[model samples]
Target: MSRAGRLGVGIIGAGKVGPVIGAALAGAGHALTGITAGVDEERVQAILPGIPVLDALEVVRRSELVVVAVPRDELPGLVTGLAEVGAWQPGQLVLHTDASFGTGVLAPAAASGAIPLAVHPAIAFTGTSMDLRQLSNAYAAVTAPAAVLPIAQALAVELGCEPVVIAESDRLAYAEAIAISTEFSRSIVAQAAELLRGAGVPHPGSYLSALVHSTVDHALSQAGSAGAGPPAEALEG
Candidate 1:
């Protein structure tokens, strides 16, 4: 719908992922009509100063594109509550960042005329001021109804991500794949830290992070090559 002119975006869960992505999208020019947070006023102000933190219902009532950034386990309950209240609007697009579930779980909202979308980012959110700095190279797995796929795609791109479309039915499987990758990297990082600890290397995390990034960059460059790029060009590069 002509990009919706920076969507009057409202975030229902101003928790870790919610505020971070909301802030990032706001930085990307979306009009963040504040956010919904159950936290006390002091705590809410600590995150986003001078921004009006409304109640969940109010967040939905105000925005044309409402993003439910609550944890995956909380999604069904949250959305169900919103659906029961008739708070969702017909033209409002409902998108969530849970990797394990799809729009099927949000069928109630869809039935209520909101476009349900599963647009999970591939990166973990720390819910801090640093979030905006970490948004580069973010990737997302998006599953949406055919009619609303463009909406999902546009939002993902706005987040500076390479969005990969997957079937809604396969969301859980894709989540598993991501789980394995994240765990593998995390496990390796843990082991590397231990090894460095034993070797008496100070601030091992810095070295370990750099090593991982270099390896990944080299591997990505190698993969980008079509033919005979002199195998293991990474080490040479």
Candidate 2:
């Protein structure tokens, strides 16, 4: 799909990442047709006011661009099911936000003539507008066919992200790197908080939160100045 003009977009999942990215794309001038409501209608409306909440398949049918932001493991099945039901439109754009898999996971939709794209933002989402700020400085891992690669990059840039093309062969490694940096860092912080609690420290979480924030900021600053990646200790600390 050539992003020559604003497109009608639909979100397949109402989870944390979906609404935020939908909102970001909306902010970038795309029209949000609808988003899947399920049991989270209230939550979805709260996050994305003015967008209609519709059934998953209905959303896909109405959209020129469909964003599949479901859990990673559910993506392939969802794409297959949609394709089986004859839901995908020819020349429509289908994007998945899974870091672990590249555009190949959307093969079913691709077979139906939907352009497949894998666009994974590197930053952790808080399911709020605050995440928009992080996106301005974050890198997004994008994978798509060469013909539509520019469209994928343009979409990432619209969401305030710098696009980094991740090869299909390196998808798992890229996903693992993000997991270690964000998830493992949280685990380390949790352990430190527990030790602080054992030592009878008052408000250990609050103190550690401030310390960690400063440490991360300093590490990022150092990495920027040094023109290199932060050391593992700096990242974990």
Candidate 3:
């Protein structure tokens, strides 16, 4: 912790998620120590201007809380490789934002006595300040050792999300639900836009935007109603 209870937060992976996480933490009064450079430097700077671009080791060395927002596939190797280099500091808070993983993926860091946490925000990030607004409506799935569970939940709340406790054993199922919702919405929208374009619509995206939003809103409302579930009968062609 820094002066007056503020943590020195460092972020690895300057991709879509990292900078946004840094920004959110900064908004919550945590000072950003620095962020790793290499991905989208422009977006990183835009989201967190004036924060130094440091190497991963230096970032780890300086931070009291480290945020790892790298891609799902790269997370294990990054944690393990950092462990190999002896980078994890004892007693430091280490959190990753990958839905597919729980703290088990951070065993290497935990072995060095670092506290491991998984707090995956449920949102499709645009890698911009716009995401900050969306965070208020988001739910973060938090998993951590029972002793440190409150820390994870508090951090998630600080990031403007409601915290939902997900057991480490259930991470895969939680991840599948997130992926399915995101991909299905994206695919349906793209297909609709393409069909409109083929039919000579000048701006299919603009044309469908309101309709899509209202339709989805209606469907969600229905799903939330008493005794609601999937339709019993299939639609006729």
TM-scores for all candidates: the values are: 0.83, 0.90, 0.92
Model 3 Cα lDDT, one tens digit per residue, 1-237: 223678999999898899999999999999999999955788789989999999999999999999999988999999999999999989999999999999999999999999999999999998999999999998788999999988898899889988888888999998999899899999999999999999999999999999999999898787757444322121100
User: For model 1, how does the per-residue alpha-carbon lDDT over 86-156 read when each residue is reduced to its tens digit?
Assistant: 98888788999889988898888888899998888788677776655666666677888888887787788
Please provide the root mean square deviation of candidate 2 (C-alpha atoms, Å): 4.6
Question: Model 2 misses residue 135 by how many Å?
Answer: 1.2
- Better TM-score candidate (1, 3): 3
Clashing pairs in 2: none
- Best-to-worst order by lDDT is 3, 2, 1
Error of 2 at 191 (Å): 0.5
What digit string (tens of lDDT, one per residue) describes model 2 on residues 55-125?
A: 88899999999999999879889999989999999999999998999999999999999999999988888
Which candidate leads in TM-score? Answer: 3
Residue range with the least summed lDDT across 10 consecutive positions in model 3: 228-237
The lDDT of model 3 is 0.90
User: How many clashes in each candidate?
Assistant: 0, 0, 0
Q: How does residue 111 of candidate 2 score in lDDT?
A: 94
